[model samples]
Target: MSTTQIASPRVALVTGGSGGIGRAVAERLGAEGMAVAVHYAGNRNRAQETADAITAAGGRSVPVTADVSDEGAVTAMFDRVQETFGGIDVVVNTAGIMLLAPLAELDLDDFDRMHRTNVRGTFTVSQQAARRVRPGGAIINFSSTVVKLTLPTYAAYAATKGAVDAMTMILAKEMRGRDVTVNAIAPGPTATPLFLEGKPQQAVESLKNMAPLERLGEPVDIAEAVAFLAGPARWVNGQVLYINGGVA
Candidate 1:
């Protein structure tokens, strides 16, 4: 008699998996043959939809929830992923909030909320990922092209992403001997609910025309980049990939 052994699939925990970009990334990774933990802050149904889609595609997925800025909650999210999938190989931090206003007029409350979600949330998730992601794993964080474009009303949001850039670089070095990679993806003008929420159609068209590609990014475009970094781009570490279609 002949015997064969099966290898376990890699597992991914995608924060904000209920949202547009996050959902695309979760599904993309799931299609790549990894079990996925789809995380949402509030909308459990949407997260479960993402998971269900993955499962329907003949992949493994589960919906998990947490407030990314809360350390205890984030810890439990990781625990849940591990309990469901056995181990984590990749973590994609797409959970963030954007509040745009001129630097002088930006409300302090808005700043605090943005900072908590974009910066503290990434920090909390990165901390846990730093401790737990297995060897040869990857940690992907979200940044924004506003940091480079220096858009006037985006000062507060850009500041948060700048912090993420700093943390990503340092974390890559800190994981020096661990064989894990840390990187950030800075996407420009993606047409997600978050980006399109408050903008007028004319303003949206202007943004679309700004890019050399003459179009706003799709969530799948960002997901494609995330898939590359999370899977094959092992040497592409400690870097911020600007996926802006030359808008900068």
Candidate 2:
């Protein structure tokens, strides 16, 4: 049977759905016959484009705008999803920012901004999902392979993902009987606008070759991992699945 013929329909909220990985995940989930709420912080146009593509392909979707770090905004976004779809079955927190600088040269303000979006944003979204997501649902968070790679100039960024890893484990245990699986996906050197912006061709090539696959991961690669956790990987909970083609 095709995904569209699945007996039960699921609803998913993918934050940062305007960008590369998040948009890919949203589109993939929509193709799986899930109603998707594509959440964007500031790019409503891109979000709408994602929703339109999903709808045109015979899936249901809507674009939502919210600041993930704002408690009230995130809450309202969740409320909108619940009202639109009855209940949320999957929540993917892909909204994040990366600021690169060696610890010694990093601006404190930059560090704070990263923490606000990457760490606090995940916490706020996870809190809402824990309270609202239905049984047998999944909550997927985004981490980074840099957390383990320990690359210089990524200290601030990796710190935020480390917090994400910690939260994923704790949230999984907290929702012990809720039947909601929580996990994080760590992608290495993906070809996203966020990753490519301001990067030199030489630097990009170096990162591409670091992986055993000898290529940078695509957004679709990470989306496939998310689809697994969201659909059939019930036993895989509270772990960070590194989807970087063995780059760790």
TM-score of each: 0.97, 0.97
Question: RMSD to native for every prediction?
Answer: 3.8, 2.8
lDDT of 1 by residue, 1-96 (tens): 112112259999999998799999999999999999999999999999999999999999999989999999999999999988899999999999
lDDT of 2 by residue, 1-248 (tens): 11222226899999999879999999999999999999999889999999999999999999998899999999999999999888999999999999898899999999999999999999999999999988888999999999999998999999999999999999999998778899999999999999998889999999999998999999999999999999988889999999999998
Model 2 residue 141 lDDT score: 98
Residue 32 displacement in candidate 2 (angstroms)? 0.7
Q: What is the C-alpha lDDT of each candidate?
A: 0.94, 0.94
CA displacement after TM-score superposition, residue 31 of candidate 2 (Å)? 0.6
| lDDT against true structure, model 1 | 0.94
lDDT of 2: 0.94
Clash counts per candidate, in order, are 0, 0
